[model samples]
Target: MDSLFDVLETNNKAMMSIAITRKGQPLYSRAIGYSWYGPVKTQANTKTKYRIGSISKVFTAVMIFQLIEEGKLQLTTPLSKYYPTVPNAARITIAQMLNHSSGIHSFTADSGYTSWLTQKVTPATLLSKMMPAEFEPGTQHKYSNSNFVLLGYIIEKLEKKPYAATLKNRITGKIGLKDTYYGGKIVAANNEAYSYNWQGNWAPDTETDMSIPGGAGALVSTPADLDKFMEALFAGKLVSRASLTQMKTVEKGFGMNLFVFPFKGHTAYGHDGGIDGFRSQAAYFPADSIAIAYTANGVNTNLNNILIGVLSIVFNTPYTVPDFKTTLYKTEELDKYLGVYASTQIPLKITITKKDVVLVAQATGQSAFDLDAVAKHQFKFDPAGIEMVFDPINSQMTLKQAGREFLFTKEK
Candidate 1:
């Protein structure tokens, strides 16, 4: 798709790599953009591995399902069975953890986690710092990286092996993913893509120390290796058909460490990962027998739109990227809508400023989104596929995106 490349190039994307396969046969592959930015200017290649953020959750989930099939563990097993030191562990079940319904507060959401990570805290010590359950176990669905961290711990305890070794022996090794590994001090040669944030400059990729965020987000892999891993996983090379079915089933938005995107009349299953500077997505459409793996070294590029564009080509669907057209407005027109808007359900606050729009969601710090005018009273997030419709009649605005909607009321 030349048009796809044009869009990316026009945006000056720092790095973009993609691998596409159908029924285990490679159909298309490409890599573009500099892996490192400087006077040296090293170009990225197919072999350049990337820190795949939360996509590592899918691998951890597969390993756990394999253990379940081997009778070494059960999904209903209580957390206390393995780690009694955790508060209220007796009341939390493995199934709850898998679906992120455990109600345990995410260590990553803790304000001090970043500081602790910088100091390189051990896994046990990280767990010890977590507070009690945010709510009773299984009360509702909430994503927490700590759940998967504990899952990694359980895998290590039950298998009597290091998490990395077990992952290699069971998943990566069995599937022959030559370039995939749990990242550590010794990164592979020609191995990983250095990551960059959108600070108007490029920098090296950063991640939480493996000892702290291990199972949740601690894997490095190439796009080719990711495609291979998904192929083997769905081919029953890693687990039984019944176990595979369970893993793909949507228990919640989060299940077995994977997020299910049941959208556009097809069930596309995968996970999207974001660390400090790397973002990755690996998705498979079982009905179409299509799998796509995309990894980028730059943050804030909104790779989701690119994936949707590629999916349109693959699925023959009509897809159009929303045009973020800006309309000239007098300062007086902007003042009427400038106020704080709040939503109780998600507990989000939106603050409109003269230059940009910002959202503060529960447990997520404030993130600024550039707003573009589409109509007299409507704005769209150019980077995030979100639309904000202002209803002056009711003095409210609705945030619509990704098949979900939330209403916000202006503060008096």
Candidate 2:
């Protein structure tokens, strides 16, 4: 139990909150780190709210199923019934959108997405920006943000109200989730956590407009509220048992806004989400009658590793606390790894740079990330499970990841 706290302190997340329950009884609940960074920092607590990101998809799915239960919607309904001009509208069904098999282009992955992601967007404007479908409807599985966005729009249309209002009346209000709601600008007074990208110091991350994520990634919630929601959802307080079964039915590795996570021969159904610097996970294991939720405002370590640690704690399994201390490297020593390195094995190039005595690595068409040095000429990016060993004398580097190695030579 102490080891779990040790892991949180060592990982140094800006804010980390976890809540776990079994048989409808809470087993553990904890929160650590600061909700706000810098001189005017505010410590996080069990009640602090964090943007849950794509976990909102799960909530959106719940609302859709509720509508179906009320005879207001049908899973087999075609998209043309709502928006005929949408690509593949004639062929795509509501179920395809729910399971992310709609073949619609993911607007979040579009080339210009980042350019305007921070700005507010109207529904029509956002839909107009969506690219044509990439594949025939239901022919293949493809996770797309556009699908959830469209679903959100449908929820709004059918409810004759805004998405946030529908969520309040149909879900959160019914669950009595005091700490969950639609997010807006971070207001320190309300205990909303500010997301950050961690390096040697916390760097404030850019805020994505809530309107852009909409039902895809806009909801804010605490771990406790998330756990409660999962419990009620599985207990049939939200949707009918038959409808819940459909949401859990897997097709091409995806269910209706739910995904299965295997742990020690047991499967948990839930979703993971990331938006800016916030990372979230919520899952419920019906066999064990357990529900767990974790939310973080900032992370430098791998998120999966964190989730594994929380699960291990809940299950009373053996787990080791990570050693967060880093070996300091001189500025001159870090400069040696600075260069553009390319690998013949893959059509990608990595440019390493020295930033304030720390090594940073950036790949082609990707954002730069700080690489922590473990030893002389050896640096690692833990988030991606990647390690790089630089041989400055030969102007070459070897990258090791998941038991595979790639060799790169510095270009002249």
Candidate 3:
């Protein structure tokens, strides 16, 4: 597993924790980097808790299923029963919400979400942001945070308690999870790790109000605790076998709050999560009785590469850790790309800027992201597989990714 360790060592993550278990036994477990980035950086241990982001939805799905098992909820129940104002509430079913087929407009996808992320959002304000359904209910599959948020509200109403309490009593508490709970403001004394985005230096990211992501992405946990939770959940300790199978069943490429992940000669059920600077992925392969969980506080490297490395090690497949070290460009080299580029075919515009010495890119409606220099005049955003090559002579830029290329003329 030295290759797995090498990947962590080479990446610019502030902290990462990973655990792999087979048949209830740990095959590999490790934590690397610091809990935070600073001269006073606290080394991350296996117990350090990072926000698990949307992984909380899996636990939320379990609660909904538990309610279903008790005859308190029905998969076919319409949203009108609880939330009348929601668009198409009379037609959208609980199962539609569970599988992201409800067509409810995701509030996070709105252009103005970043402006309100830091402020506390009341339930009424949150509802107001729902806008309208994107399409006819149950017609097509489109993932939306609004669906999970509504499910959480339903859980709260039915349980006669807050969503956090329901989560604790119904899932975490039942699974004996010691380090999993709803997160709030970052409390350093509590050993909660704040997330960061890496460029040349680790830049701290803003924390979203927990209320904004509640029941959808508010839970904080260590990888070990998450691995334990998934094991118990799949072993029929959290939900019934019937409900578990339903959660695993996919429709239009989406299951009930779960996604299908196929690995070497085996299929696994899992979810990937991202909120703020933290990202996570966890999966369980029943065929092999193996479970793997990874959490990161800062990610400058592509997460897929890390997961592929870990899984390859678990399956005894040959894998190589990537060499991430790259050549540094001087200030003069960066200044040449600092300008606005516009494409006639697309309404979006790309603006590149240099902060100190780090190159950053911002498009219409999106926040700026640091772009790493992969080669002279060629920079890339690894997370999105976006590569930008600049032609100073023609004053043009070529953007390539996903087997397509677009050319943009540099604007004076």
TM-score of each: 0.80, 0.95, 0.91
lDDT of 1 by residue, 223-255 (tens): 778888877777788888888777776764665
Model 1 stretches with alpha carbons more than 4 Å out: 185-189, 203-205, 320-381, 386-412
Candidate 3 global CA lDDT score: 0.86
Residues 1-412, model 3: lDDT tens digits: 7555755566663368888889889888887777777778887778889998899899889999999999999999999999999999999999999999998999999988989898999988988888777999988999999889899999999989999888889988887898899999988678788888775677788899999988788899988888888899899999999999999999989999778999778788988888999999889998899989988888776678678777887887988766665559877778888899999867879999987767899998887888878787888887777889999889899989777899999987
* Superposition error at 37 for model 1 (Å): 2.5
The residue pairs that clash in candidate 2, if any, are: none
Winner on TM-score between 2 and 3 is: 2
Count of residue pairs whose backbone atoms collide, per candidate: 0, 0, 0
Off by over 4 Å in 2: 10-14
What is the per-residue lDDT of model 2 for residues 1-412, given as tens digits with 9 covering 90 to 100? 5565656566673367888899889998888888899888888899899999999999999999999999999999999999888898989999999998889888999887888988988988888866678899989999998999999999999999999999999999998988888888888799899898877777798889988999899999999999999999999999999989999999989999899999887789999989989999999999999999989988777778778877877777888877655679878878778999999999999999987778999999998888888877888888788899999999999999888999999998
* Residue 287 CA displacement from its true place in model 1, Å: 1.7
Which whole-number lDDT from 0 to 100 does residue 311 have in model 3?
A: 82
